[model samples]
Target: MTTLMEKAHAGVVTSEIKRVAASEEVNAETVRKLLADGFLVIPKNINSKSEPIGIGKLMRTKINANVGTSRDNVDIETEVEKARTAEKYGADTIMDLSTGGDLDLIRRRIMDAVSIPVGSVPIYQAAGESIGNMSSDDMFNAVRKHANDGIDFVTVHAGVTQSSFERLKRSDRILDVVSRGGAFTISWMKHNCMENPFYSEYDYLLEMAREYELTLSLGDGMRPGCINDASDRAKFEEFIILGELVKRAREAGVQTLVEGPGHVPIDEIGLSVTAMKHLTGNAPLYLLGPLVTDIAPGYDHITAAMGGAVAGMHGADFLCMTTPSEHLALPDVADIREGTIVTRIAAHAADLTKEGVREKAREADRRMAVARRELNWNRQFGCAIDSEKAKMIHARSRNADTCSMCGELCSIKMMREVMKK
Candidate 1:
């Protein structure tokens, strides 16, 4: 059987690409070209019957919600609810970074519950107990376990090689090695006095990926943690390795997505995405918050959206939504809903700027313009992305047609009345 990449190369549009194009409201050939060029990827394992979700260039920017349990918080029920909340609010995908009790069961249950593409970082399970005991074999076994369980995508920290560590030692960043997976791999390398197994034994990983047809999310282990650490030596060194791994993976017939920066200042986000695209040859870039500011603990979602909009508009393919619970605690159901909606808004805003991106958002904005001209509250709500929230907040304001901020002297409403003949 031909992989999606092969089928695409042969000019055969697979069902996955077709579905993605239909969802994005673009031509299937556009999607096929993106896939062939390694700009877009449909993460669906061969053995798994899960539906495909596209992430990359020339498509609607997709958002992914991270839902999992920490050791202190191990409620499978709550995680499932968060997953459901994410789906309801508009998360294109979900990554189960579970490290708590019953890791395998939690993942399987989440997969069964959600129709969206599911992703997992296998190293989390390998190093869940302690970073000391996490050997290469442990990591490999965990990835295979995830593949056997039908995870649509697996994040492998294959870029944090020994050479990258050498680069990190000379650099002085505010938060050195903020990625948990990167920390684990670096610790393992220092302890064993050996090279990174993921880099050394990449073919074995590629074979596993090819067998399951799993999309390898080449994890950004050396990504900057703080705004000061953005675009440092450690980050680029790992990226060079990731680019090589991406070329090799494509040769092995396995799909790939390149994970990107941890946190970056607003001005630097564009440069970060552009550099990654140039280095990695435009492979799908999945970014964390790339949070613009260091402050705003409770409003990281807003901070993330600010940066995400820039990243998506520049070149990023996927936006990982940061909840209000970010840098604090595990997000509950409400947090997931808010995070997903906020990120979706960011993605849509960015899509408007991107060439040949989503049309619905722009069309909705056009409808809202018409509604404001006609003084139609119902139409305004109908055109809103979060109509329920808009309606509820408006209802609490004491003004039926006008919000409390504007009241009876609403400019738009007043303008409509004055302009009427």
Candidate 2:
């Protein structure tokens, strides 16, 4: 039962490696080397039939859309619709963070509905089952259940240890902890007066991860909630712990990636990303917003995209889509669609500056530019990230060759006439 990492170390290029290689347009050997070195991760649970995706060095920056039901809004059908809509709109992965209803059924339904890798935060289910009476065994059991259920990846707050908790107490941050999983781990630790089980029993966790070839997304439990709390001592302390854990996971031949900050000032996003990458031995970084500003409750998606583009430029490997309802409410299908497209745009925008994929990303922009210059409305829509949205918006304008804003005063048309003369 060799994991992908083990297989790669053995120099065996498996079908997953080939599929990822073809999708990334990189050599199969390059993918093998990256996987073997623990720089690239292809998260495919053995039981999952989802497509293998390469995330990390030399691969296009990927976006993940999170869809799930909260206790207040437990509509499984809507959740499933959001899952399919996310994939259709260009999400590289889907994470079912359902905390209500039958968690297992919802997770499996979402997995069956999409062809991309699926992830989950096991602690959510553990807490749902045993809010105040959660035992160390309960947490481990949740992890095992998700792995056995074929979740491609799982977010474990192994870094929220007693030591980091002490550091958190020493700090006077505006927002101490914003991550739901992080808060859960801290609450369990405090209530039980014990160390975080995931941290204390990491070896056992590693064994289960290896058994399922599960990619451990070492969750940033101490991620800053607001811009004011960015880069605090507690956050960096947790990062140091996660860095050590990253090495341990790699040594154990288990796939892993490090999750990063939630909210960061625009100027600090790049620095934060670089420090995390260096500290974690350049393991793939999956970022949640690092939302550049604290304002814009309704438009957090735009802020997240702005921050994501910067993070990607600074080598962040994956962006988790932050919907307009980020702080307001759970995202509906429309919000999921918009968020996925926006995040995909941000990922591509960052890809334009990346080394290996820059030219490939630029080619799309080039096509869009050509279409615009020629007043090729159809071609423009074809090149858009959301073709339907582009068409819908364009349909508002009566003119076929130009939009409403520049009906007869269209610059492209005027430029064409002058150039022809």
Candidate 3:
């Protein structure tokens, strides 16, 4: 019944650690040490059977795709397809954020559909069921339900306490709180005139997490909703609380990750990422868009990728994909695929600068370069992250060896002929 952290602490390398180590190209003992030190987290609940992934220092930057139903749209099959698409397109994890339909059924269906780790936000269900009148028991029950349904991780806004709320009240934020779960927690606390149950009863929460071996993703409920609100006191106060919660979770042998900002200006991303890493004692940092700008409504995925690449370079361990439909509407399957691929690109871009995986990342680019030099269309497509797209684009040209852009005037072909002489 020992948790993975507990086993790691005892110097016992579990099969999960071995798998993660092998996947990460690190020694099993190294994975064990990192887990024991709370630097890496493998968020596989005991009841869930999925491929283990390592997220933290020395590991490849990971990407997460969110697929779920909203109040206006409730189709379990569509959400399941989104989950499958996310996994097929290389998402490291899938989070079921359904607020409509049977949340339990939707969550279990997503878990059944994908082999990657699945996560959820329990407060959404708590608020959905009670309409903001949820008691502490209602919140705890939602978390327990998710764990029992084999969700590998759950986002708990344990850091959004009354003190953090007071800080928010005193602060000047443009858009205020943008996180749905955060707003739910705040509304519930205000209605009941009580401290956040998750914060006040953290020990109980940790105990349940240990029992299920579920990873706790400390949700950033006070994350800035706009670039103007970035780096405010409320956000930092919640971060400080999350940092302490992380220490407690580690002490209790529960795996943990700290969620980060919603929106931030481009220049502040590095500081935001490093500050979160430092505050949480290097617990694997999971981040939402941290969207650098608010202007690109139709292309927030691009903006988020830009921010994600910078955040990863600065030590963010995990990224949540932001779809093109962000701030607009619920994303369709195509949007999910596009977002997942773009986020993967961002993660790989950052991995090229990271320590352990830089060489591996560079090898792909090297192969692409060599392929381009030889004008090997097949090989070039093979080296591409989206080979189908590459092949499609290449097929547009009438000439097989050279693309339409340059035809016989291709620079690589010219350079090759000169070099051969």
* C-alpha RMSD between model 1 and the true structure: 1.5
Question: Which pairs clash inside model 3?
Answer: none
For model 3, the superposed segments whose C-alpha errors exceed 4 Å read none
Instruction: Give the poorly placed runs of model 1, Cα more than 4 Å off.
Output: none
Lowest-lDDT window of 10 residues in candidate 2? 128-137
By TM-score, the candidates rank as 3, 2, 1
Candidate maximizing lDDT: 2
Query: lDDT for model 3, on a 0 to 1 scale?
Result: 0.93
lDDT of 3 by residue, 1-421 (tens): 7889999999999999999999988999999999999999999998999898999988999999999999899999999999999999899999999999998889988999999999999988988666566789989999999999889999999999999999999998878899999989889889889999999999999989998999999999999989889999999999999999999999999999999988889799999998989999999999997799999999999999999999999999999999999999999999999999999999999999999999999998999999999989889888888888888887889997889999999888898989995
Alpha-carbon lDDT, every model: 0.88, 0.94, 0.93
Question: For candidate 1, which ten residues in a row score worst on lDDT?
Answer: 355-364
- Candidate 1: tens digits of C-alpha lDDT, residues 28-53: 99898888777789999876767788
Q: What would the TM-scores of all predictions be?
A: 0.96, 0.98, 0.99
Q: How much lDDT does candidate 1 score?
A: 0.88
The candidate, 1 or 3, that scores higher on TM-score is: 3
- Residue 304: error of model 2 in Å? 0.7
Displacement of the residue 113 alpha carbon in candidate 1, Å: 1.1
